[model samples]
Structure formats: structure tokens, C-alpha cells
Target: MSALPYPPPPELGWYDEDATVMPQQTAETQPAANAQPVASAGTTTAANPPTTAEIAQTTAQPTTASQDDDDIDWEGTVLSTAFTASAPKQEYELYNEQTGQRIIVDTGVLLGRKPSQDLPQGVKAVKLDDPTRTISRNHAAISFDKDGLLWIEDYDSLNGTYIIRDNTETKVEHERMRLQAPCTIRIGDQFFTFEQR
Candidate 1:
């Protein structure tokens, strides 16, 4: 029998009539005509994304003040005024036992070695200058809460803060404790008495 003839080899050229040519698809290339483009990570799709005109319109709109007169709640204001009026009208006085100096704390008081210039609007600074330098520059603070209750907080003092009540001394740090009248507060070697006036 005669040997079978081999098929012809494929044409190798830029333009081959019988060869099937396919375009390469790459990340940098545009998508096919009928293929839907994909959105990258964290990117919004064109189907529901905001248009440039909409974004510009939103940005061009003028902003009004958040607190308008019509938005005020008169009932809430009346209730707040009533609560404040019912609260006690008591004041506290801090007297240094050793130095014989007094500070009348109407709102709040900050006790330290040197006077603090950046104290809050209603807070007073009382200087406790010691010859031994045991007290910190910002040692302690005394404030009255909304309910007219006194509170004492130690401002991370080196020697610590002590509250002496009824012959007992309790060290306080980091947290504000309820301070009663006729109690002594000891910061380093200086002692101050909190009395109600």
C-alpha cells in the first residue's frame, strides 16, 4: 500500500490566510466590545455611582447654621432651668493649715505648686509653694458636680494625694472621690481643709 501524504504545515507570517489569529487580552488592554468592564477593589461601579454634576451641585450649596431658632426645644430648656434652680447653692473654702491662707472655691479649684495660667474659665488656681519641693506643679483639683457634690481628683502627683477624714488617711489617685466638708486634703507635706460656707 502507498504511504499516506502528511498535512501541510501552518503558514508563519504576519498575514496568514488559513491561520486563525486571536488578539491578546491583558490587564492594560481595554475590554472586548460586548464584555462588561470590572471595577477595581474599593471602587464604585458606573451603574449607580454619583455623577460629576451631582457632586458639584452638592458642593456648591450654601450651608446654614446647625442651631436654628425653630429647632430649640423650649420644654427641655425649662426642665434644665428647673433642675439647676433646685440644686443646692453651697460653696466650699480651702484653707491651708500650715500657711494660714484661704481660697474660696465658687466653681472649681486647682491646687498646685505654681499658679496655672491655662485653667478653665471658672476654675481657680491655688499655689502651694513648698520649701522642700515635694508638691507637683499641677497636683490636685476640686470641683462640684451638677448635683452640688464635691469631688477631689489627684493629677498624677509624685508623692500622691491623701484624704484625711475622722483620723483616717486614704490615698487617692487617677479617680475623683466624693469629698465631704470638714475633711483635710494632704498633697505632699501641705495640708488643706475643705469647709462648706
Candidate 2:
């Protein structure tokens, strides 16, 4: 037969002098109060506890930023195949095949540019001219996925893609960027940077 679980410390006589005591502990630990005998394990009843589903739900919740960053090794390549005139956004996805966290990097949110040019160069062309744009939501981006691949997608703007692999700058004329591990992709004038996720 399975052994009985250990009783919680609260069920015992242990107590902090400064704090109030529970009714169960008072009888066993406080003789001055004229307490009665403590109930045995079979005689005592456990109050409502967390349901199995509730416990599973809490544990299944998405990992926090710190936890996710710490848990995954995160290394892979980036591939982009998205661009349009009105919303010229590209998707930067990684394929690590290890942790299996699909990290997505989009351009529309990363770099802010006009809907005309595919790869608009210069700081001003990327909407960085307006100070508010930076604070707004038009900044360039570089992110990794669960698989550990890096991504650099355009943010549906005039400016195109930029790459800084091994400290060298290169333009991505194609809509997609097939990059290996530990590569950085910059989009628009802001030149967002991202590592393998």
C-alpha cells in the first residue's frame, strides 16, 4: 500500500510566537488555554483542496518572460515570406526543433515606413523622423522562436529588410530572409536587431 502523505507543518504544533494560531494547533500546543487532545489523522477531515483540473491549469499557463528565456536554449534560422503594399508585413519565424516554441517576428510592428518602398533606407524614411514614432509602435524588431530560429520581418512599410551578420550590413531584396543561427536581421531605417530564439 502507498504510504500516507506527510502532514503539513500547520497540522502539527509548530507556531510563530508573534502570529495567531489555528484552532487545530491550539488544542495540542497550548496547554494554558485548557485545549483538548489533538485529533488523529483518521479522525481529522481535510478541508476543500484545489481540484486536479485547477492544479493542471495553473501549471499549464504560459511561461513568464524570464522563465521562457531561461528554460529554452533557443537557436535556429529565420525565414520571411510576407510583404504587401498596403500592409507590407513579413513574418520572421524560427525552427529550432528542440524546445518547440514558435517565436514569430513581424515587420509591421518592428519598422514603420510608407507603403510604397519595399526596403526604404535612411533614418527619416523609416518614420524615425517623428520622435513620437519611436515611442509609438513603429520601431524595428528582431526576435527568436521556440525552435531557436531568428527572424527579421518588415513592418508593412516602405523600408525593406537589413542584415548584420558577423558585423557586416546587407540588404534583403527578397521578401524572405533565410538566416542561420546567431544572425541579426534589421528592417527599415530603425534597423531592428534579433538573435536566434
Candidate 3:
């Protein structure tokens, strides 16, 4: 399971691979410079930036997908897989227990502040409203796999990601964790419950 690669965070946006940055500078503070400051990825140089050819190969769009549904007005995140008539089709409803908000999810979802807006072809992301500022820009992801299973993946967020069920709270570890409906998902202070539709 290869996760998509997004630009580091807004705090780190000032540092691009081409615009060199001095080693003494940190993410929080930057001084005015006449020349564009480039960020060095260890030995990376402005002459040779990393290419997205590798990323595109890994996160390519699926050959077959359904975009006819407009009831939810949001297309599910379609993972790269072979779609077949025998594939199981299951939809889940993500409800905000606190706000009574309902979100119907079938394909996959990238949850954070504002994801994919910057990426030209990145997977469309669902914006998570977090005035508390605990969630990262690309905080977590929910993907329905080809095998008809749901998985939750954490993006190494600052605070953390977790799943709670049966009165026991379990953290979403580094790897993607399998998720069952009728459970609560916590990204930072926000909480949402999922049930099969």
C-alpha cells in the first residue's frame, strides 16, 4: 500500500527543492534574502530536482470508474485496482456524532485541512474543520480496497490518529489499519462514527 506524497506542510512550504536555504534557518523563521533560498534534500541540488514520474507510476488513476452518481455530490476516492462485477460493493456512512453531519463514503477519502488542492492530479481530499489546529494538513486517509475492506492510515500527524471501539481506544499505527463500521475514528480532537449503509 503506497500512500500519496504531498508537499511537506505549509510551515515547510518556504523550503522548496530548488530555492536553496541556509543550514542555519528553521521552518518557523526565515529572513529576507535577495536570492531565492532553495531547500536541499540532503544531497539534492537545484539542477536536479526529484521527478514525479515515480510518484505518478505508483498512484495512477484506475482504468475503470463510476462518476455518474451525483446524490452525494462527492466522488469516492478510487484506488488503483481491477474493477470487476464480482467485486463487493459496500457503502459506509460517516456521521459526526457531535454535529449530526452525514458523509457517505464508498471509494476512498483523504481527510485533512485542505489536501489535493495544490497537487495537480492528487486524490481529491475532504476538508476537516478543526479550529483547534490539532490536525495536520494531510492528517489521515480512509480507503476502501479492492477486497471490499476499509483501512485507515495515519500520515505521521503531530498529535496522532486513533480508532475507538468496544470501549477500547486504539491508535492508528504507522501502517494502515483495518477498520470496521459502527466504530469511532479520532483525528486529533475531532471524532466521527462509521456505519454500513
lDDT of 2 at 99: 27
lDDT of 2 by residue, 1-197 (tens): 99999876663344433245545655556576554556654343235456788678778989777546545534333344432223333455533232233344443223343323444332122233333232223434444444434444444445555677778987755454545545554443333344333
Error of 3 at 146 (Å): 1.1
Greater lDDT among 2 and 3 belongs to: 3
| Candidate 3: residue pairs that collide | 19-37, 19-38, 20-37, 20-38, 21-38, 77-108
Q: Model 2 compared with the native: what TM-score? A: 0.26
Candidate 3 off by > 4 Å:
1-86, 118-123
**Model 2 lDDT vs. the true structure?**
0.45
Q: Using lDDT as the measure, which candidate wins?
A: 1
Q: Which stretches of candidate 1 lie over 4 Å from their true place?
A: 1-87
Candidate 1 achieves a global lDDT of 0.79
How close is each model in CA RMSD to the real structure?
21.7, 20.8, 25.9
In candidate 1, what are the lDDT values of residues 76-97, reduced to their tens digit?
4555655656446777787886
Cα-based lDDT at residue 37, candidate 1:
64
Q: Name the better of 1 and 3 by TM-score.
A: 1
Residue 60's lDDT in candidate 1:
90
Q: TM-score each candidate.
A: 0.56, 0.26, 0.53
Q: How displaced is residue 154 in candidate 1, in Å?
A: 0.4
